[model samples]
Target: MDRPTRWTRATVYPDMWVDPADDPRNSDGVSPDGELPTLVDYLGRYRATLLMKCDDLDAEQLARRSVPPSTLSLLGLVRHLAEVERDWRGWITPGAVPPRLYGSADGDFEGAAPDPSLVARAFADLAREQAATDTALAAHPDPGERLGADGIAVRELQVHRIEEYARHCGHADLLRECIDGRVGQ
Candidate 1:
């Protein structure tokens, strides 16, 4: 069997705006039942799509800034997502605080650079943080559980995660296009 090719920003998209299940509508087959898993599934799919868009590019390409003064890059987005996941976990997991991955607060955006190693590290950190968040969510399925001192509900956090992924995925589309001619999601 042939091995699956790694994805890259230079690669043309197979299709655009389809859900993870390959359905035409982004929300198709999301979850007819109710919230909970539906929200998690949507957010997870968005996060996966964003990473897929970045797949196979070299660290240099991943770290390439969109434009001067923007400091936005595929790597930066990955790093930022790692921070977001960690932050959410910290809020929800009570006393199970995990140390920040990108140094101090705002470090994800602050420490971003065009360095190859930094880019690679950002991707790795994202993977780790994502795994931790999934584990936390699985361990606590109740959507009504309050997260953080702000008293945000688990369901609300999941919804916020979906919003975060959608917004960043949109940014990823533009950044990937800027890096190369490849377009669509």
Candidate 2:
């Protein structure tokens, strides 16, 4: 028996919102040129992609779960990434710090709700953590430099963050498409 082939509407717009040649986001402007710059660029792109997925959505839409028995939502993704950014920052620059952003539990996802305030706070926290992480890395240019008590390499931390953002961005794509008919690659 011939199995049914699967096709996705996600690629219906092969250009992905705009012609590749005219897309400003893909433009390699006067941005820095180096390994660090490349890694940061990819990570930043994924971060922006996630936010784009959450665009045009109200708190309720964002907080709506895609399927039952799962806590996953656009808002939850934002909160979880905020927590992840903070954790990665701590790994690279652990020191006298303030209290936890949302306590030690799974507050990130657990607290994600259909509240406008929570949505705003999650975005703010994500931006703050990402900036701090960049500043910390800039102060220590050596990617191979061991950091914190564990002596983890800066490269490992940076790579991990990129991977984290990439993974979540994929999830965001699915969640957004489910919320609306909008789809992309």
Considering every candidate listed, which one attains the maximal TM-score? 2
What lDDT score belongs to each candidate, Candidate 1 first? 0.76, 0.76
Model 1 stretches with alpha carbons more than 4 Å out = 1-32
Superposed on all Cα atoms, the candidates' RMSDs to the truth, in angstroms, are: 6.6, 4.8
Q: Which stretches of candidate 2 lie over 4 Å from their true place?
A: 1-15, 18-24, 29-32, 96-98
List model 2 lDDT by residue over 1-185, tens digit each. Answer: 33223323333355374445544357656766887777778788888778877878899988988677788898988888877777776775668544568875577777788999989998899889788778888887777889987898878887898998888888887787677655664
lDDT of model 2 at position 43: 81
User: Per-residue lDDT of 1-185 in model 1, one digit per residue for the tens?
Assistant: 33233333222345453334553335643364667877876877788778777866787778777777877888888999999998888887668677778787767876877787898788788888889888888776788987677788888888888999899999988877676645666
Candidate 1 TM-score over all chains jointly:
0.78
Q: What local lDDT score does residue 153 receive in model 2, on the 0 to 100 scale?
A: 86
Worst lDDT run of 10 residues, candidate 1, spans 2-11
Clashes of each: 0, 0
